[model samples]
Target chain A: MVAHATPKSNESKPIAALLVAAAVAIVGILIVVPLVSVFYEAFSRGVGGWWAALADDPDTRHAIWLSLTVAPVAVAINTVFGVAAAWLVARFRFPGRSLLISLFDVPFSVSPVVAGLALVLIFGRQGLLGPTLAWLDWKVIFSWPGLVLATTFVTLPLVVRELIPVMEAIGPEEEMAAVSLGASGWQVFTRVTLPNIRWALLHGIVLANARAMGEFGAVYVVSGHIAGATDTMPLRVEKLFQEYRQPASMAVASVLAGLALVTLVAKFVIERRLEAESRDLEAARGLENTRLEATRP
Target chain B: MSIHVRSISKSFGSFQALDDVSLDVAAGTLLALLGPSGSGKTTLLRIIAGLEFPDAGSIEEDGEDITERHARQREVGFVFQHYALFRHMSVFENVAFGLRVRKVPSAEVTTRVEELLRLVRLEGLGGRKPSQLSGGQRQRVALARALAIRPKILLLDEPFGALDAKVRVELRQWLRRLHDEIGMTSVFVTHDQEEAFELADEVVVMNHGKIEQQGTPDEVFDRPSTPFVMDFLGNVNVYHGRVENGRAFWHGIPIDYPAYPHAQSREARVYLRPHELEISPPGAVANRLGTSLAASIVRVTRSGPITRVACRPHGSEQELHVDVPTETARGLQITLEPGTHVAITPRNARVFIPGPEYSI
Candidate 1:
C-alpha cells in the first residue's frame, strides 16, 4: 500500500507563468536595471574618465586602498571568531546559549549607525575606554583602526550566522565518533569537524568579506570622513557625488557594484556546489541502500 | 578485558536516564543491553564508553578505574546506530583514522586498515567514501574503524538498527562470527529482543532506566524475573486478580500460582506465555500441570507451523492467546473455531504481587 496519497499537480499554466513573470519583472527592476545603469553611467564620460576617477583622484585611490585593507582585516578577525563561536554554540550545550546566539544577531537587527555609535561610546576620545587608550597614545575615533573596528562590528555576524546552522546540522555524532576512536579534542576538531564545515566556512567568509568591503554607515560614523586617511570606497563615492563628479561617483559606485556582483556569483557558486555535494552524497547513499537491499537474502 | 560498571546513575535535567544501574562484562564475553527506547540501555552503553558521564557511580576497565577518563583515553571503540562513518573520508581512511590520530607508523596503519577491511569483507571497496557503501557496508566500516584502535572494549549502539530486516539478520550473524574471532569484550545496545538473544552471551533487559533482568538468553526467556521482562520478551497473557490462602482467584475461580515472599499483598498478577498455555475440550483433563480455566474460543489464526487460539475465560473480559502446533490441531477430532469452548491449562505461570513496577 502506498503510504502517502499523492498531491494533485493540476496548477494552471497561465497562473504559473504569471507568477514567474511577476518575479522576473521585480528582479529585473530591482537588480538588473540598477546593475546595468551603474556600468552605463560609469562609461558615459568614456574610459579615460573612469580611469581618471580611479587613478587620477588620489582620495578615491586612498579610499580603494583603505577599503581593501580594512575589509581583509575585518574578514580575517571575524572568520576566526565565527568558527570559534559556531563551534561553541553548535557543538556544546550551555546556559545562555540562546542569549549568546541572539547577541550575534545584534549587528543584523540593530541599525548600522547604532552599532557605530555603540562602538564610539566605548572607544571615542571621551568614551569609556578612550582615556586609557589615549594614555597609550592610541587615536581610534578618526583613524584606520576605528574604520576597521566599525567594519568588523558590522560584518561580525555574517560568517557566524552562516556557520551555526551548518555546524548544527552536521551534529556532534561525528565528533563523538572521533573521540571514541581515540582522537584528542584538537585532533577531532581538526580532522573531523573542520573538514565537514570547511565548505560552509568558505561560504561564510565570502559573505563576511563582501559585507566588510561594502559597509558604509558604521564605517562612516567612526571614520570622521577624513579625506585621504579614513574615507572608504562608499564614502569616497558619496564625496565624489557631492562634488558633482558624476562619472567619478558612478565609477567608484560601479567598482563597488562589480565587487558586489562577484560576491553574489561566488556565493551562488559555493551554495550550488554545496547543494551538489549534498545531493551526490544522498544519491550515493540511496544507491548503497539499493545495493544492500539487492544483496539481502 | 573484563569491565565493571558500578551503581551508575545519570540524570538529564529533571529526567533520570539511568538510575543506579550496575553491570559486569566477563573477559571476552559478548553482552547485550536490551531495552525499549528511553530505557537507558544506550545511556549505560555511552557511560561505559566514556562518551557520557554518570552523575554518580564508577566504571572500571579490567579493575582499573576509568570513570574520570575522557572517551579518547578510555580506549573503547563505539559504533553508533547511524554508522557515524566519516562521510568525507574513504573507507580506508575512515578505518585508519584511529591509528593515524594515535600517530601510528604509516606502514602499520596501512597494513592494519587493509587487514580490517578484509576482516569486515570489504577489501576492494576501501577506496570508496562511506556514502558510496551500503548501510550494512557502512556499519561494517564503522566496526572496522573502531577495531583499528585494538580497543579493550567495543561498544555498539543499535548497530543494525538502521538496516532492513534481511540485512540486519545477515549483519547480526556476521557480527557474531566477527566477535568470536576477535574475542573482544563487546557490549552492544539494542531494543530488539531477538537480536539481543541471538547475538550476546549475556543479555541485560532494562526498562524505565533500570535493569529489569540480566541473564543468558534462555534464562531471561524461560524465566523472566519481572513482569516487564516477560511482556517485553514476547507475547504474554496477563491475569490480574486477588490472592488469598496461597491461591489467586480470577473471575471467582481459584488458580494455581507460585507463592512469592511478598504474597501478603492481596492483589496479584499472573503472566503466562502464549505457548505455555494448552487448549483442550472444555472438560478434557490433560497432564496435571496447573489450574485449568474454561474459556470460549474468541478467534483462531493459523500462521505457518503454529495455530493460535484466542480465548476469553468464562465471565472474564481478558483474552488469553494459546499457540499449538498446526499438526496438533489437525490431529484433534474437534474443530477449533470461534465460539467453541475450550479448557486452557497453564503449564507454567509467574505470579507477582501487584506493584507499580509490575504494571505494564
Candidate 2:
C-alpha cells in the first residue's frame, strides 16, 4: 500500500518570501529609479525637444560618429596586440613573466586621467620624444591618433585577460599532435588552436570594443574635444552638460544606454551560438554512437 | 623491418629515465618491453616511434639510421595507452590521417582506410568518431590508424591497459592474431606478465632504468636470471639460508641441491614458487628432508578452479600460501584448527646471496 505523508508546516516559505521582497526593493531602487529618472529628464519640454536636440545638433552628430568610428579601430589594434600577448603569456615561461602580466592590468588599476597625463608627458611638446616627433611634423598629443592611443591603452587589458585563461586551458598536446601528423605550424594554429579559442576571442573583442566606445578621462585630455575631429560620446556628454544643453546630453546618454543594450544582446547571441554549436556537436556524437550500437548486435 | 637501438639514454635534471638501454628487433617479430611503472618501457617505445629523441644514441630502421628523422618522416606507427585518437575526426578520417597528411590520392586513401578498418574488425564504424566507440573499439581504431601507413616499426605502449578484464584478454589475442596476419616488426610495452607472456615472441624485463633480463616467455618465466626477475615474473617464496658443499640450509631446514655448485657458503636466500611446495603425508619419507610444520590453516581462497590455503608454521608466525587442487585440500580437510601437521617439499628452487639493500 502507498503511504500518505503529512505535510509539514510552511516554515521555510517566509524566509524565501522575505528575500524576494528585499530583492525586488533593491532592483527597484538601483535600476528602475535611475532609468525612469533618465527618461523623465530626457523627454522634458515634450518629445519634440529631445528629437530636435538629436537631429539639429551638429556637434552631437559629430561626437556620435567619432565615437562609433574610433572604437572599432581602437579595438582592432588592441586585438592584434592582445592575441600576441595572450599567446606569449599562456604558452611560454620566462623571467619577469609575472611582472609583464602585471603591466597589462596597469590601465585598470591606475586612473584614466593618469594614463592620459602619461601619454601627454611622452608625446606632448617639451616631452621626451616630442622634440624628435616635432622635427618629423607629427601630431600625437592633441590629435585623433592621440585619442585612439589613450583609449586603446585603457581598454587593452580586457581582451588579453579573457584570452589567456582559455588559451592556457587548451594544452599544447593538440598542437604537438597536429605537428606530428605533418601539419605545418600555420596549419596547426589555424586548424587546432584557432578553433579552440574562437569564442574567447569574440568575447574579448566585444568587451574591448564596449570599453573603447565609453572611454572618458583619457580621451578628454588627449582629444581637445574637437567638434568634427575628436569628440567621443562620453566627452560629448560632458560638453553638453557644461554648455547647459542638458536634454541633448541625456539623449546622448540614452544612446549609450542603447549601445550597452546592444552589447548585452550581442553577448546573449554569443552565448546562444556557443550553446548551439556544442549541442550540435553532442548530437552528432550521439548519432554516431547510435549507428555503431545498431551495427554491433 | 629491422629496428636497431644503440646506447639510448635520457636524463631529466638529476633523474635518469633511461641509461644506455639498447635492444634489437628482427623483422616480423613482436618484442615486449615488460617492466613496472617508470622503468623506461614507454620512453623506449617513444624513442623508436621518433616521438622522443635519445640523448646520446642512434636508432636505425632497415639498416638506415633514422636518429635525426622527424616523427612524420620516420614512418613509424604508435598506439598510445589512451589511443590519442583525434576527437574531431571520424574513425575513417582518423585512420586515414597519416596517409592524407602525406598527400596520398583520395581513392587510395579510401581503399586503404577501409581495408584497415576491416582488419581491426571495425569496418562499418568508419564514420563514427572516437568518442562514440567503446574502450576496446577505440583501441582497435587507434591500432588501425597506426597501421594505415604500413610503418616499418609498429609501437604500442600498454595498448590494452585501459580496458575491462574480458576485453583486455579478447583484444590481446586478437592483437596477436593481427600481428601474425600482418607479419610486421612490432614492439609493445606492458607491465602485465600475462600480456607479455601471451603476446610477445621475446620479453625484455627492465628494472631501475636498466634491462634486468630478456628472453623468450618460457625462458624468462622458468629460468629467471636475477632475484628481481624471479619475484617480478611470478609469486615466489624467499628463504634466507646458507649453501655449504651443495647443501643449502634455509631457516634451520636442510635443502640439498647438487645443481647449485656455484653458490657461496655465506648467507644466502633461496627463491621457491608456491606451486613447487608438494604436500606429502606427514612423517613420511620425502624426496627432500625439510622440517615438517605443525601449522594451522588461516584462510582458504578459490582462484579460478584451484583452492589456495594460507597457513602459519607451528611455534612461529611466518606465513605461507600454497595452491592445491580442490580435491586435495578437501581430502586433507585443512581448517583453522590448531596443530595441523603438513609437510612441504620444494622441488625447483634457486639460491642467491642477499645484496646489501635487497633483503630485510
Candidate 3:
C-alpha cells in the first residue's frame, strides 16, 4: 500500500523548515538577547553586589514590599469577581448580558494609562467622587489603594476571559443533572461545576497573577511614584535608573524579569498538563477501539 | 410513583414550546414520549423532573402537588442526552455523588455504588474516568449514576442516541430488561419509533406541543388517532384520494374505511404502511371489494430478510412502495424489471380528510 503524507509529516517540508528558523532568529534577536543582557548587567559586579543592591537600598525594599502587598490583594479580589462574573455571564441570560461581557474587556482594549487616568478622573481629589472621598477622609490616588485599584483594573479580564469559554462549553447539563440527582445549589457548583472548570480557573489565576505583578504603565500613572511609600517594584527600577544607578536598576529589573521567566515556565507547565489531560481522554477512546479489535474473533 | 401533569404551557420567546398539555403516568409503568424535534416531549420530561417549571400548570407526584418544588427537592433522577457525567471524577465517585451529597456514610456509599455498577454490568470498570470508557460504557455509567439515588421516577432524554447502531440496539434491549428488573416508574423521551415501541408499555405521541394520542404501543400501532401520529410512527406512503359512500377510493381501488360510512365524496388522504402492502402478478387475486391497484414494477431491493419493491400504477404518475419478506417475494415471483405489470393491494390503510392546510 502506498503511504499518504499526513499533515504532521508535511511539516518537514523546506518551507516549514525555513519558517521555523526565521521565527527562532527573530525571537533570539528580539526577546532572548535583551533578556540575557539584563541578567548580565545585573550580575556585572557579582552576586554579592546584586544582594547588597537589593538589601542596602531602603526604597527598593519598600517597593518590593509594596508590590507584594498590593498585587495579591488585587488578585484575591479579582478571583472572587472572576468566578461570579464568569458564572453569571456563562450560565444565565439577563438584560445587557453581551454588553456587560464586552465591558469586562474594556481594560484589555483601553490603554493602561487611560484606565489609570479614568480611575483618577473618578476618584481623584477633584474628580467625580472627589467630594465624597475628601469628606470621608479617603485617599485613593497616590496611595497603596490606588496601586491596588490600578492593578486590579489592568488584570480584570484575564481570569474572567479564561473561565467564560470553559464554563460555557460545559453548559448547564451537568449542573442540571446534579440538581435532579438531589444536590443543592451549592453542592451542584462545588461538586459538579467547579471540578469541571477548576483547571481553567487555576490557569486564569496564574495569568492574572503574572499580569498583576508586571503591571507598570497604569501603576506609574496612579502611584505618584513616591519613594519608600507609593513606589512599586517597576517604579523603583525606573527611579534607580534615572539616578544613574544602572547596575542596581538592572538588579531590581532582573528580579522582575526572573519572576516573568518563572511565570512563563509555570504557564508552559500548566498548558502541557492541560494538553496531556485532553490527549489522555482521546487516547482512552482510541484504546477502547483497539481493545475491541483485539478481542474480536 | 404516579405523575400527573395538568395544563402545562411554556414559551421561550415567541416559540410556544408546550401549549396547555396534560398527561398522566401510571405507577410502575414505563412510558415513552415519542415525537420529532420541537414536539415538546423533552420539555414535558424536564417539567416532570423539575429541571424546568411550566408557565401555567401544576405537577403532582403520588397525589401531592410539587410544581413549586425545586429540582434539588424533587428526588427525581434525570439522565441527559449527552450523559452529563462528572468528567473529573472516577466512575465510582460519579456513581456515589448523589449518596455523598446526601451525606450517606462512606461504607454505605461504597457498597451501594458497587451494587449499582454490577447491576449496570460495569463492576470492574468503575475505576476509570468517564472519558476513559466507550460511548456505550459511558451511557451505562450514567444510568448507574442516575439509578444510584433510588429516586421515585427516572427520566432519560434519548439515552442511546449517541451510541453506534449495534450498541444502540444492545443497550435498548438491556435497558428494557433493567426496567423490568427494577420496575421504577420511568419516562423516557425518544424520536426513534422502534425504541419507543420496544421499550415502553405506554407510548404518548406528541406533535406541536400537544399530545396527539396516548395508549399502549399495540393500541397506538393499530389505531393512530391523528395523521401526525400515523406519519410520525413510521415510514408511510400517502396518496391523494377521496372518500365516498363509506369507502376510501384511490385510482378506482376502494380501501376499507368502516369508520367513515357517510355517502360523501370529498378530497381525502390515504396512508398505507409499506409492509402492509402485498404485490403480485396482475389478475392473480380475485379483485373483490376493489382492494387492489394495477401497477408495473419499478424496482426491487433485497436486504437481509426483507424485500422493498417500488411499483408505479398504470396510467398514473404516482408510485407505490411495498415491503415483502424475501421468501414471500420468491414465492410470488416478484421481479425488479421496471416495466413489468403487477398488482399492489394494501391490507389496511388509514383515511383522513385534509384540513384547509396541513402542516407536517
Candidate 4:
C-alpha cells in the first residue's frame, strides 16, 4: 500500500519548474543555436583549408592585423573623452548639463547605417570643408582616418555611460579628503578618483573595444573596404562572402568570433574578480564589527 | 599657528548655513565646535578648512589672510568622519599619499610613512589595503594620512561619530593623548556634548549658524551664555519669568537673584539645570522656595548611582525630571509612586530676556 503525500501551502512546485525550463530553453535557442552553427562552419572546412584560412592567407592576415590595430586605437581615444565627459557630468553643475547628457542618446538613437551616411556626407568630397581638405592634400573620407573617426563616434558613449554612475557613486568626499591632505587637483584625480573608478573604466574599455572590432557599416562606408588597405576582419568577411570564398570567409569570421569570445571570457573574469573583491570587503567589514564588539568595555 | 575667523556668513541659494560666526584658536590647542544638527558647526569647520566660501567674512592664519586660498593651497590636514580612506591604497601608501603628491623623495616618503604608521599604532598593517582593516584601524590610517604632510593645522569633522559607543569613548581618549603628544593646533566638529567636553581644550557652542558662546569646557558647561546653549548642552528646566532690579519673578512667584542682572521689568525666561532642582517636603526650609507646586511622580529611572524622577505638576501641565543620588531616593520615607505629592524648589536658575520663538 502506498501512502498519499500532502503538498505544502504556498508551494507551487510545478509552475516554478516549468518557468525555469522555459527560461533555459529560450536562452539556448536565442544564443546557443547561432553560436554552435558559426563554430561548426568555421572549423569544419577541411584541415588544410582551415590552416590556410587561419594562417597562410594574405587577406586573412591583413584583416586580422587591421582589426587588432584599429579597435585599440578607437577604444583609447574614447577612454580619454569618456573620462572627461563623465567627470563633467558627475562633478560639475553647469549650463547644458541635461543637453550634454541627452547627446549620449544620439549614438543609441540613430542607426549605424545613418551614422555611416552622416560621416560620409560630412567628410565626402562634396561635403562641408571637403574642398579645403582636398586643397590641403589630405583626404578625410574613404581612409583609415575616417574609419577611426566613425568607430570612435559610435563607441564614445560606452565609456562615458559606464563611468558616470561610478564617479557619482564615489562622490566628492574622497577627493576632498585628498585635497585637504595637500594633494593638487591632478594628484587627487590620479591617486584618489581614478583608482576608485578603475574597474568601471576597464569594463567600459572592454565593451567599447568589442563594439569597435565588430563594427561594419560605418567602417565599410568610410574605408571603402579597400583590399589589404583599410579592410578590417568584418569587412574582409563580407568581401570574402561576396566573392564566394566560403572557407576563407568562415575562417576570418571565426577569428573575429574568437576575439569576441576571448574578450567575453576576459569580461567575465574581471566581473568575477570585482565580485570577489566586494565580498572580501564585506567580510573584512564584518570582522571589524566583531572586533569592535569584542573590545567594547 | 593661531587662526582667526571674523563675521563669517554664507548662504546657499536661500538657506543660511553660517551667519556672522567668529572664533579664535590659539596656537597648539584643540578647539571643538559643539552644536546640534544644522547649527552650523560643520559649516564653520569647513569654512576654516577652505572647503567652503563665506558670503561675508575674513580669515587669518597666523595673522596672514587665507580666506581666498584653495583647500589644497591652505596647507591643512583634514580627517573626515567616514575616514574616507582610499580603498585601493595600502596603509603605507595612504600615509605617503600627501608626501607623494608634493613630490617628496621616495626615501623620505618611506621614512615618514613608517613613522606615521607607528604613530597610529598600525606598524605591521601598513602592507594591508584599507579594505582589509577594521573601521577603527581605517580611521587611524586616515588620521595618519592627514598628518603625513605635517600641515600647520589639523582639522577633524566628527572624526569618531561613525564609531560605536565604546569605540567612540576610547578614540576620544586616544585623540586627546595624541593631541598632547603632537602639540598640533587642531579644530574638530561634533554634536556630542560628552565628546566635546572630554576632547576639546576649548569648546565653542554654536546655535542657528551663530557662535552662542566660547570658552573652556568647564566654563561653557557651568555657565552657558544663552537659553539655547543651556538647553542644548544638558537637560534643563526653563521657566517663563520677568526680572525686576536684581530679582526674578515667575508669574507672581518671586525668588532671590543674587547674581541676576539689573534689567527693566520686561518678560524674561529663567533656565535651571535638572540637577539644580531639589525635591523637598512641603514647608521645608530650602535655598529659596521660589514657587511651591505640588507634583506627582510619573516615572522613575535608575542609572547606576543616580535615580531620575520624572514628575508632572499637580495644577500645571508642565513635566520635569530631576536626577538625585540613588541613596536619596530611598530615604524619602514615603512612596514616590504615581500621584505622590512632592514640592519642587528652584535652587539655581539663570534668567534671560525672552525671544519671540522658543521663549521658555
Candidate 5:
C-alpha cells in the first residue's frame, strides 16, 4: 500500500531529483568551491599574513577606504534620481514617454566600459566641459569624483526599474482619495503613495547599494589606478596579484566575496519578509470576508 | 450645502467624456446619476469634488462659486468605488487621517475617530489594517474617513459596485439609512437602475455624455423624455411604424394613437413595457379595447409570481415579450407553453419620432 501510494507527481520524482542534483553539483564546482578556495588561500599564510597584507599596507588600507567612501555617495545620488524618474514615468503620460522609459534601461543594456567612456567624453580634462571645470579648478577624472560618477552611472537603473512597475500598479487613485480628503499635495504623497511603494523602494536601494559597492569596470577606466589615492579595492587586488602576492590578492578578494554574501543574505531576508507580509494580508482578507459573511443577516 | 454645476464639459484627446452636463443637488438630499459605461457619470462626480477641472463650467456650493478651488480646499467628501483605503494604515488611522492633517489635538482626534468608528459600526476593529477588512467594511471605512473632515457634500463613485449582489443590496439599504440620519447632500453614480430607483430622491439618466432624463424615480420610469432613457430604464418592446392623420400603422395593422404629438412624422417608434403588453386567449374580449396582434408563443419563462411569455407576431420574425401574473394566466385558461396561439394587446404605449438620437 505504501509503495502504491505514489501520486501523479511522483512519476517525475526521479528526474526532478536528478536535475536538482546536477544543479547542486554545478553550483558546488562553479561557485561554492571557488568561494571556499578564496578564503582558504587568504588564510593559508596564517592570520598575521592576511592582516599585514590588508591593514599594515598603507596603500591597501587607502584602497579599502576609497571604495567604502565612493559606494555610499553613488548610492545616495542614484536613489534620489531613481525615485524621481520612476514617478515621472509611471504617473504621467506625455509625448516621448516611451523614449524616456527606454532611456532609463540604457544603463542596464550598455556596457559599463562604454558608460565610462561616454562620461569621459563629456567630463574628461580635454573633453566638452573640461575647460569650464578646469577654470573652476575642479578636478573630476583620475580622482575619487570620477570613480563615484562612473559607479553611479553603472548602477542608476536598478531602483527605477524596481519602482516603476510597483508605482504603476498602485495607481493614482489612492493619491486622489487623499487629496480629496483635505490632504495637501505633499501630505498625500507622504501619507499614501510612499507607504504603498516602500518595500519596492527598499529592495531597489539594496540592489543599487550592492552594485555601487561591487562595480569595478567603469571605476577602473576612470580612476587612473593611482596607488595610495585613487586605486580602489578591486584595482589593489589586481595589483597585488600581478606582484606575486597571491595571498594578499586572495585576502582582498575574500572581503569582496564576503560583501557579496551579505548582500545576498539581505536580499533573501527582505524578499522573505515581503512575501510574509503579502501572505498575512491575504489571510487577513480571508478572515475578514468570513466574518462579514457570518455577521450578515 | 447645496451644489450647483452649470454647463460642465470635459474632453480627453479626441473623445468627449462630458458634454454640457448641468446638475443641481439640493441640501439634504441624495441624487443618483444612473448611466451605462462611458456616460460621464463619474466624470461629473469628480468635477463636483474638484478632483478634476472641467473644460467649461462653474461649480457653486452654498451660493459661492468654488470652481477654481483646489480639491483640498473644496471640503467635499469623495468615496472611490475601489474603497481606496491606504493599504499600510489601520482603519483607525485612516479615519483619523483628515483630522491629523488638520492639526487636530491628539485627545480630540482619538475621540472623533472613535466616534466615527462607532458610527460606521467598526468600533472593535479600529486596530485592524484595511487589508484585514471585507469589501463592505472597507467601504464603510472610506465613508468614515470622508466624513471625518465634516465635508459640505458627499460624493461616491459607484460605492457598491465592487460588492456581491447580496452585499450590494444590504449596503444600499444601509446607505439610505445613513443618508436619512445625517441628511447630508449626497451624490452617487451607479449603472444599476433598480438601485438608483430604490435609493435616490432624484435620478439623472445619462447616455453618450449627456443627461437624457432627470426626475423623480417614478417620473423617469413612467415618462422617459428620450428614447435613450426609455431603452435604458427597463425592458421594453419597440414597434417601428409611421404616423399619419393621427393614426399609426405597423405591419399592415392599424394602431391606436390617442392625442399623438408626433402625428405628422412618417417614422415613429412605440415603446411598451413588458408588463403593459397583456397576453390573453386568442379571442378574448379585452382585445377589443386595445390594439391586439395575433402571435404564437415562442417561449415561456416563469420566475416567482410573474410569467414572461415570448411571442412571435404572425407574419413577422420579431418577438414581443409579455409579462403576466401566473394567476392571471391560469384564470384566463391560456397556457404560455411554446407554440400556443395568443393575442398580445398593448394596454399602454408611448410613441416618439424616430431619429439618430433615438437609436440606442
Candidate 6:
C-alpha cells in the first residue's frame, strides 16, 4: 500500500530527487560556481594585493564613492515618489489615475539603456532643455546630475508598484477609524498607515537600492568613464576588464556582488513579513466584503 | 449628543445608496438603522458619523450644522464592521493612539487606556497584538480604542455582523449594557430585525435608500404603517382571494374585512401569519363549513420553541406553512404525521388589494 499522501500529492520520490539533484547541479554550474569564483578570484593575489589594486587606482575609489552616493540619492528620490504615487493612486480615484499607474511601469518595459538615452536627449549639452540649463550655467549630461537622473529613472517603478496592492488590500477602513477617533491626517499616516506598510515599503526600497547600485547599462551611458570624476563602480569594472586587469576588475565587482547578496537576504526576511500581510489581507477582505457590504433582498 | 440627518441624498455613480433619507437620534438614545443589504442603513450610519458627506444634505449635532467638518473634527467614535485594529501595534498602543494624538500627557494616556481597557473587560491582555486575540476580543479592543477619545457620538456599523452567532448574541447584550452605562448618543447598523428590536431604544427601518418606518419596537411591530413593513417584519402566508360586501373570500370561505368597507367587488389577497391560523382534527370543523379548509399534513418539525407544519390544501398548488407551539402540537392528540388530513381555519387575516399582478 502507498503511504498516506500529503497535501503535496503530486510529489514522486525518484522524480523529486532527480529534479532536485538536477536543479542543484544546474545552479552549481551556472550560478553558484560563478558567484563563488568572483570572490575566489578577487583574493587570488591575496587581500593586500587586492587592496593595492583598489587603493592604487583613485578612479576605482572615486567610482566606489560615486555608486555609494548615487544609489542613495536615487533610492531616496524613488522612496518618496513611490510612496506618494502609491498613496495617491491607491487611495484616490481621479481621471487618468490607472493610466498614471501604467505610466509608472514604463521604466520596467523600456530598457534601462533606452531610459539613459532619453535622459541624454532631455539633459545633454545638445539636448532639449540644454539651453535653459546653459543659461542657468548648470551641467547635466556627462556629469553627476545625468547619472543620478538615469539611475532614478531606471528604479522608478519598484516602490509604487510594490505598495499599491498592499495599500489597496489593507483598505482605508483603519485610516477612517483613526480619523473618526480624532486623529489628524498627518497623524493617521505617520502612526497608522506607515507602520502597516513599513515592511512592504522596505521590501520595495531594498529592490530599488539593489537595482540602483548594480545598474551598468544606464550609468555607463552618462558617466563618460571619466577617471576620478563620474565613473561609477559598474562603469569602472567594465573599464578594468577592457584594460585586461582581470584581478582588479573582479575585486571591484566583488563589492557590488557582496551587496547584492546582502540585498537578497534582506529581501528574504521582508518577504516573510509580506507573505503574512497577504494572509491578513485575505481575512480582512472576507470581513469587509461579506459583512460590511452585505445588504437586504 | 443628538444627531440629526436632514434630507441626505448620496449616489455611487449609478446606484443611489441613500436618497433624501432623514432621521433623528435623541440624546443618550441607542438607535438602530435596520435594513437588508443595499437598504442604505450602513450609508446613513456613516453619514451621521461624518465618515461620508451627503451630496445634498446637512448633519447637525444638537441643532448645530457640522456637515462640512471632517471626521476628526466631528469627534465621533466609529467601530467598523471588521474591528479594523492596527495589526502592527499592541492593544495598549492602539487604545493610546487617540489620546496621544490629542496631546494628552503620557501618564494620563496610560491611566485612561488602563481604565478604558478595564471598562471593556480586557484589563491585562493589553500587551498582546490584535492578531493574537479572538474575534470577540478584537471587537472589544476596537471599542476600547474608539472610546479612548471620549467622543460626542458613538457610531457602530454592524458591530457584530462579522462575529459568529454566539458571539454576536453575547456582544449584543454587552453592548446594550454598555450603552446604558455610558448614556451616549449611539447609533448602530444591522439587518437582523431581532437585533434592532432588542438593542435599540428606537428602530429606523430602511429599504432601497429610503426609510420605511421608525418607531419603538412594539409600535413598529404591532402597527406597521406599510405593507412593506408588515412583510419585512416577519413571515406571512398569502392566499389569493377576492374581497366584496365587507368580506374577503378564499374558495368561498368568508373572512371578516372590517377595515375595507368597499361596496365594489374586486380581487385581493389575504395575508395571515403561520400562528394566525388554527389546525383541527379531521372532522372537528364539520359545523364550521364556510370557515375551514381541508388539508393534509405534508411534514411537521419541532425546531426550537415552535413546531412548523407544512400543509397542502386540496385544489391548491401552493404549500402553506403553519407554526404551532411545540407543546400545543403534542397536545392536539391527533395524527400530526405526514398524509394525515386536518381542517385549517383562519382566526383572522389582513386583506390587501392585489397589485397589478398577483404576488406572494
Candidate 2 lDDT by residue in tens digits, B1-360: 999889999876678888998888899999999998888888888888777788988999888999998786777777876666666678998888778777899999999999998888998999996767887898898898888888767889888777767888899899898888888999999888889999999999997778888899999998888888898877787776677777787545667657567645677788878776665445642423445444556766788767776666555666776777767666764342334666665567787666774543
Report the Cα lDDT for candidate 2.
0.79
Candidate 4 interface RMSD (Å) = 3.7
Residue lDDT tens for model 6, B1-360: 988888999998889999998888889999988888899988888888888888998899999999998887888888998888888889999899888889999999999999999999999999998877877888999999988888878989888877777777898999999988987899999888889999999988888899989999999887666566677888888777888878998756888877668888887787777987889886865664668888899999888889899999877878888888888888996958899999898776777785553244
lDDT of 2 by residue, A72-175 (tens): 98999888898889989998888899999999999999999999999999999878889998999999987878988998999999889988887775556555
Chain A agreement with the truth for model 3, given as TM-score: 0.88
C-alpha RMSD for every candidate? 4.2, 5.6, 4.0, 4.1, 3.5, 3.4
- What lDDT score goes with residue A42 in model 3? 96
How well does model 4 score by local distance difference test?
Answer: 0.82
> Model 2 off-target regions past 4 Å?
A1-9, A32-107, A119-140, A143-152, A163-170, A221-224, A246-255, A272-297, B105-108, B242-248, B253-267, B285-296, B325-339, B354-360
When summed lDDT is taken over every stretch of 10 residues in candidate 2 chain B, the lowest stretch is: B285-294
- Report the lDDT of model 6 for residue B97: 84
lDDT of 3 by residue, A1-297 (tens): 123566555556777778899999999999999999999999999999999999999999999899889989999989899999999999999989999999999999999999999989998998999999999999999999899999999999988998898788667888888888888889988898887777778888888988888899999999998999999989999999999999999999999999989888888887887676567545654654554454333
Question: Where's the lowest-lDDT run of ten residues in candidate 1 chain B?
Answer: B283-292
**Predicted structure 3: clash tally:** 0
CAPRI verdict (incorrect, acceptable, medium, high) for model 6: medium
CA lDDT of every candidate? 0.87, 0.79, 0.87, 0.82, 0.86, 0.87
Query: What are the per-model DockQ values?
Result: 0.49, 0.19, 0.43, 0.43, 0.43, 0.51
* lDDT per residue as tens, model 3, B52-125: 88999899999999999998888888888878888889999999999999999999999999999999899998
Q: What lDDT score is found at residue B64 in candidate 4?
A: 95
Instruction: For model 6, give the RMSD to the true fold.
Output: 3.4
Q: Enumerate residue pairs that collide in model 4.
A: none
lDDT for B340 (candidate 3) = 80
Better of 1 and 3 by DockQ: 1
Which runs of model 5 end up more than 4 angstroms from their true locations?
A1-18, A277-297, B250-265, B285-290, B333-336
Please report, as a value between 0 and 1, the fraction of native contacts recovered by candidate 2.
Answer: 0.13
Instruction: Please tell me which model should have the higher lDDT, number 4 or number 5.
Output: 5
Rate residue A245 of model 4 by lDDT.
87
